[model samples]
Target: MNQPVSGFSKKSKAEKIEWLAENYLQNNLRSVQVLKNYWNDDPSLQQLHDDFIENTLSNYYLPFGIAPNFLINEKLYALPMVTEESSVVAAASNAAKFWLERGGFKAEVISTEKNGQIHFNFFGSEKVIEAFFEEIKPKLHSSIQAIEKNMKARGGGLLALSLVDKSHILEGYFHIHATFETLDAMGANFINTCLEQMAHTFEEEARNFEAFQKKVTYPEVVMSILSNYVPECLVRAEVSCNVEELTTKHHEGKHFAEKFVRAIEIAKTETRRAVTHNKGIMNGVDAVVLATGNDFRAVEAGVHAYAARNSYYSSLTHAKIEDDVFTFWIELPLAVGTVGGLTSLHPLTKLAFEILQKPDAKELMQILAVAGLAQNFAAIRSLVTTGIQKGHMKMHLMNILNQLHATEAEKEKAMEHFMKNTISHSAVVDFLGKLRL
Candidate 1:
């Protein structure tokens, strides 16, 4: 679990490194082995790599130093996230808290059977699936029956299936689709295993054709491998806050929320704006995904892919006013993990999980959803007020000033040239020299 002050100890770098290693490896040889094997045993290098990997992995705990006061459909939450953008936690937390201060941000998330997809190719004519579904759909029950020992015991089962026409990404090459509902598992391993077993049986039954691939899918997948992105399972969060709470500067969070709402569309954009836009979301999602050791890149890809789900690809979240109060919302596939991950091994990741007290999968999704929402708020706030580059460039110039040991006047000058948005270290140095400090 991450500490309230993550890495804020006044301990020496050496001591901090030791703490990280012990937490990450259980003092295992694996940490030392990988350290020596890959990093040439450079303590500094290993520490840096650990920081990057873990932050990239379990980095969700970094943002929101001051927790938000918000209610999701009347449920209370204290959200933590890891991101660099300004005003996200402050904005979302303040917004939610402001609403709750008067009443609360009430909302609901509808439920559905969570599922991934499987695709099979039989090397025969594409028309075969029409005749084949009648034969195989019945047998799918028996196959599910075999796996029911553990799943049924847990109060879940194979839910349903539907065959989809093949989608061709390549010329003259296509496949068939089957969506099987694996209840409550997040269905990563179970669905894939069951489908593979079913595919082998199909191959035997068909006898004349070859079965190529059987795997899960994303928002819309062709079946190479199934991502846990289940479009059918959507949880929508609706919220409300009084305008008095919003405009009160101190308590009227929606007052700012409205100003932000009208002005913040730049943050909701795709294209050049979408890069950092999505990056900020990853700041929250990737950290949670990492803490649980889920394949974050897959989750990352699916999220952006789904963000572009409509004719126009845009933001992961939406905000508006409702019920005489301000409201915010986000609906995206949150395929994050909770147990059976590298968190127990990676020192920082483990610590982050510790800070969170290791919330269960559903609870973890709530945390991640909050993070995504906050990150979105931060990005949009910046885009509307000044532009996304101002604060980021400020930090970049600060780093350059540190390296150059430039004077105060030189630092100020360098900051200006830097904010001109050149995005080069050389430009910072040139401005520093011109100051002659």
Candidate 2:
């Protein structure tokens, strides 16, 4: 059994790796070498990565790829994507190309409001608490004026603040809900700072309130933090073309459109299917979000929550056929920024923005929504026509070849064979076995 040791974090990098390898990795020589091999050669660059987190190991990597010809808002762009999945970038690129001749994608920013909350408990009379909140709301806004100055100067800052009484739901529970317009930054730090300050001011004033002073205990602050669920910060992206234009070599346009709409309908009414349906959309959203150095996890949480806003999770993408036209679209909350976090710090993130023509926060939101919409269109198009496995397995062939340790000649032969034959793990393995003979 392994035992916990003291001073693990205090240990040097080599020492920490040594101890981890011995205790946790069972002294696997290859594992230790693999970990060390990923370390950066430049000490300065390594230090930059090290500063990102504690107990830093060597850098982990994902493929950075581009999905080109994404036309949004009458402008063309090449979207950067970072992912391990094989077909995501390909699917997105194919979708972008498919729509390019059909007028590409249309997108818009629905809103740009983010929010946070300060939750507290008060055992005082509800009427008294309401009066105290009315009096203290102005002070709460004034308390964060200094903090909001820089943000305000940039045309972004606190938008509104209000007191919410949740005591009916949870006894003694009340909250101060605050909204913001962060402009070009995912202002977690800024919002968090203001929330903490407001919480401080709230408690201080409550402690001195005459009604509270009359009681033995006053309102107790639970916590202050920014919410990732920014439903108001949303964007919509869509593609539309004549149903006749939707025809592929494999399927007729009218039939294809009918099947595509049915697939979305199934996802909308079915929870299990919706989860995977939405996950496919996130495959595109997350890839672009990661490539741009934005918070994909937060975006995922907010989007999933939005999907369930009607009390049941469903597809994020919707499709319709009207007047001989086929339309597909997606609308979801996305809180992304272009000026803060790793956007400025990471070299690749900087390149991604340059590739995107340097969009602001709102533009980035629109572009991301388009990427997601395009991805879903490609996936549904494939699913309703050729089936998902044919393309997915074709893209996955190289990964399987690498895992099987096929030589150059074997890989070339395998690729040609799979093109003519079914591409399945068992079939590939059997063919390789015979080829080795």
Worst 10-residue lDDT window, candidate 2: 211-220
**lDDT of all predictions:** 0.56, 0.92
lDDT of 1: 0.56
**lDDT: which candidate is best?**
2
Measured with C-alpha atoms, the lDDT of residue 82 in candidate 2 is 99
Clash number for candidate 1: 26
- What residue runs in model 2 are displaced by over 4 Å at the alpha carbon? none
Candidate 1 lDDT over 1-437, as tens digits, reads: 53343653565544655566677667775665554444424666456555644332111233324355656545666554444444344555644554466555433334445555556543444455556655677775576567666876766556666665544664333433445444434556766666666666655555533332231211222354455555554544444455555454233455567666664355466456655667676766665555455567767776777777775667666767666666666776665555444545555555666666666555566656655665565556566555766655655566668888887877676666665566557877776676775
Q: What are the RMSD figures for all models against the true structure? A: 10.9, 1.1
Give the top-scoring candidate (TM-score): 2
Model 1 weakest lDDT span, ten residues long: 212-221
lDDT of 2: 0.92
